[model samples]
Structure formats: C-alpha cells, structure tokens
Target: MECTICKMGETKASDITVALQRGELSVLIKNVPAEVCANCGEYYLSDDIADKVLTQAEVSAAKNAEVEILRFRK
Candidate 1:
C-alpha cells in the first residue's frame, strides 16, 4: 500500500502500540494494525481501530483502572 503521508512506494502492514491520553486518563493499545511508510516511518491507523481504541481507553479511564506494563521473555 502507498503511504498517504510520505507518498512512498509501498508501505508494510505492522502492529503498533498507541498511547492515548485525555486529562488524567491514559491507556496503551497493543497490536494495532497500521500501514507504515518504509522511508519516512509514518504510521496510519484505520478509523475503526481508532474508534475502538478510544472507546476502550474511555472505559478504562472511567473506572480509574491502573496501567501496568508486563514483560515476558522466552
């Protein structure tokens, strides 16, 4: 796919983690699909995924949930 931002040749689909913040609320999304530009490294997310992420973030923030970072190695 062509990159909309950089207008590069072809972009690769990759899984990206997005961090969102609103007021005192913060949430991190994992494995979000995006088309990344090979040259400029620009990422684009679909509207559907953006909406889902926002919704999840709002729900989590409403509950005042804690954000934890976990690391696993094999």
Candidate 2:
C-alpha cells in the first residue's frame, strides 16, 4: 500500500519494534508485524496487533514493571 504520510514511499509488511509508555512503565515489544513506510521508516500496526500490544503493556504495568522488553507473541 502507498504510504499516506510519505507519498513518495510504499508501505510493506515488515518486522518492527514497538515502544510504548504507560504512565511510569516503559515497554518494548520486538519483532512485531507492521506496515512500514520505506521512505520515512514509520511503523503502522494492524488493529488486532495494536490491541494485543496494548494488552501486553497493561499486564506489565499492572505488575509494576518500570522497564519491560519482550518478544511479540501471537
């Protein structure tokens, strides 16, 4: 698909790292499936993947994790 953010580039399926901060918790999930803009290096996750990531972050935060790094799990 064509990238809206960068009209010059196309988005392709790629592996990405997702970094999110929920309050004081910092979470990083690696090897996530996403649509990446070849020109701008933007990562766009699907709705299902986004929801899963958020849920993982929530679980980490609820456990009072200050810093968390994990692999993306389907």
Candidate 3:
C-alpha cells in the first residue's frame, strides 16, 4: 500500500512502536504490527490495531498514569 503521508513511499509490514499522548498522559506501545512506509518511516495501523492501541491508552489515562509503556500482544 502507498503511504498517505508520503505519496512516494510504499508501505511494508513491520513491527513498530507507537507513541500516544493525551493532555498530561503519555503512552508508549511497543512491538505493534503496522504498515510502515519504507521511504518516510511513517506507520499505519489497521482499524483493529488502532482501536486496541487507543483502548490501552484510555485505560492508562483512566489510571491517572503520567507515562506508560506497554508491549502489544495478540
């Protein structure tokens, strides 16, 4: 698939880290499956993956976490 951010780049399957922030909360999720742009290094997560990541971030925020690091698991 072509990367939306960098139209010249094609995306490949890869594992990457995702950083998400909300107000004072910061979340780092590692080893996530994504489509990564070879040229621009931009990553695109699938709808299911994105939903899971967001859910994790929301859970962390609900716990009043200032920062959280998590490993993605199927």
The lDDT of each candidate is: 0.70, 0.91, 0.93
Give the residue spans of candidate 1 off by over 4 A: 66-74
Model 3 vs. true fold: TM? 0.94
**Candidate 3 residue lDDT tens string, 8-68:** 9999999999999889999999999999999999999999999998888889999999999
Number of the candidate with higher lDDT, 1 or 2: 2
Return the clash pairs for model 3, or none: none
Which of the two candidates, 1 or 3, achieves a greater TM-score against the reference? 3
TM-scores for every candidate against the unseen true structure? 0.72, 0.94, 0.94
lDDT of 2 by residue, 5-42 (tens): 87888999999999998678899999999999999997
| Angstrom error at residue 67, model 3 | 0.6
CA lDDT, candidate 2, residue 5: 85
lDDT: which candidate is best? 3
Clashing residue pairs in candidate 1 (N, C-alpha, C atoms within 3 angstroms): none
Model 2 score (lDDT): 0.91
